[model samples]
Target: MGNNILITGAAGYIGGSVLANFISRTSGPIKAAQISAAVRSEEQAQKLSKLGVNVIQVDLVDETAVKEAVLRNEIDIVVHTASAIDGRIPSHLIKALGQRRKVSGEETYFIHSSITTLFSEEGGWPYGQVRDTDTVFEKEKEIGGPHPVRQTNILVTEQAKAHGVTSFNIVVPHVYGRGSGEWRKLSVSIPAYVRTSMAHKIVYKFDKDGHPPAAHISDLIELYALLVEKILQKERIPSGEEGYYFAMAHRTPWWAAMDRIAQSLHARGLVAESKPSIWPSDKMAADYLGFPVLYVRAMGTSSGDLVPVNAYRLGWKPKWDEEQFLASIDDEVQAVLELDTVKATIFDLLTSADK
Candidate 1:
């Protein structure tokens, strides 16, 4: 009977790290129950068992199973870490808090996994599509905008307050670091094109030295450390009245991020480019995307406006470079591919020998 905390999506990219952080804390025994990643596979559960994390299955879609899990586990605190990037928060939220599950001697802390990509789409959102809920949410007077996750963040923030549950909306901006999640895929978002181009040319300056700030995984963990204190110990979370707090570090224009990545690749002479167009060179591409490439080209604009809550004033500053940061990611990709290649070669050789 541990001071049981239930963390959903425990094996995912973000959740895995979060779970690991909790397990390593200086505090005494704080037993955590993590939902396995197998989706529904017993074998995956067995694999998770080897990791020493209390593992189980509780799919949010199945209402009966969810309720039963909550009841059976006597879950004291729930860190609802699951999120669907495609704006599934609305459909899921009602069910998540709708049913009356016994949470005795138990408190719930709902933290949202909303990302910055929601703003990456076209039509300026909610402004164009019917489901584009931007207008409606702003009408409800929620701060922030058109991104679907923005609404999701707002919803969780509001619901946490409404239900007397402690909720905090941790809005992560282009999070990148050692972990394979955002650090790996982020190249596709901001740094990839320019970093890759560095191998060929030298035109990759960051729109006049734009600041492309990034949140290190360690800085993020530090933020969560205080957050855990605020919620569980001091019982000051979900400030019912105060809602979402953006969890991004100040990374500048997207171009700046790209520039940093480019610099690193250039150092290695992997690529080179001078005066490479940071924004979309063709209007057709911009029009097709419907979102402004200016967001990428301009420095200290869009992303800079998203500041975090002062409550987390750990005085944390970003120390990682987008260039080396991303270069390492490139290294990881190459390394993994190299491993796969070796495996393939070994298998082929073995097969030939058998033949």
Candidate 2:
């Protein structure tokens, strides 16, 4: 427990969840005092400080500041969850953390948060099975073609190995369920779909599209804790090509998810129809939802089969499944319904459609 752990995006969903988990861990290789979080604001710092996390206000874009934070703190373990909207992490920070290990002569471990959508982008889903090792970053002729996040992950993997720092890239997909963190209550993708459905009075899914892999926030957090323990124990944690860990419990089909949610709206009399339908066209779907066509396509066609082969090898199991997610649809959608602005938006959409 002499090692210090620095978590970036400590107030965000994934980072905050990791922070909360480590702070509350009763018995582990990490202690609450051994953990610190890089926050961006004094308000966020005050909130985390109350929870016993040593908070350092940081400008994540400033590479010099990021490097100094690691060197000054003598940080041994870094869990990076902060990223751009497209899931891009700073390569400079990766270099900085690696350099810190050399200066302090302390073996450092890094847990980089990536996404399983990389696999789905690789052209294997309903028909073809994809393991963590079957990463699509280097795959040719993908559905969405080349992706920015995939490129970043490949770069980070090579960089971490080049610097001799022990690192694991945890890839998660379609995270659902409520977060235990202090900031950001909901995930971005699914909630957008829910809001769109409420606004359009239609549940949309692509024809013949399969379900995507998904995990609850708590389960994903557990995987992070497990990986932390493995790294601290100096276990032969996989790295490089085999280092990717998929944090998925259930593969929820696109149609099934839309149907459940649409049915809930129908039951509440919010929509006249709850049955799932094929989106007319990529352009039309994009226009209706007010999102880019690429994003809409990514939401629909990017889903495929993803397996947690690496995570299972480490004896980590997910307690939540699709059944739990299905059971919570009422609460999940109702939470969206309760938003005052969301209520106003829905009313306007419904009234406009009547014209």
- lDDT scores of the candidates, listed in order: 0.44, 0.71
Question: Model 2 scores what on Cα lDDT?
Answer: 0.71
User: Which lDDT value does model 1 have at 14?
Assistant: 53
| lDDT tens per residue, model 1, 57-148 | 65555656665565565554555555533234323433343333323534555555545433322213223222221233343243365444
Report the Cα lDDT for residue 247, model 1: 57
Every model's TM-score = 0.63, 0.84
State the displacement of the C-alpha of residue 326, model 1, in Å, after optimal TM-score superposition.
Answer: 8.8
The window of 10 residues in a row where model 2 has the poorest summed lDDT is 340-349
The residue-level lDDT of candidate 1 at 144 comes to: 65
The regions of model 1 sitting more than 4 angstroms off are 26-47, 84-106, 116-146, 180-213, 266-301, 313-355
Clashing pairs in 2: 125-304, 125-305, 211-253
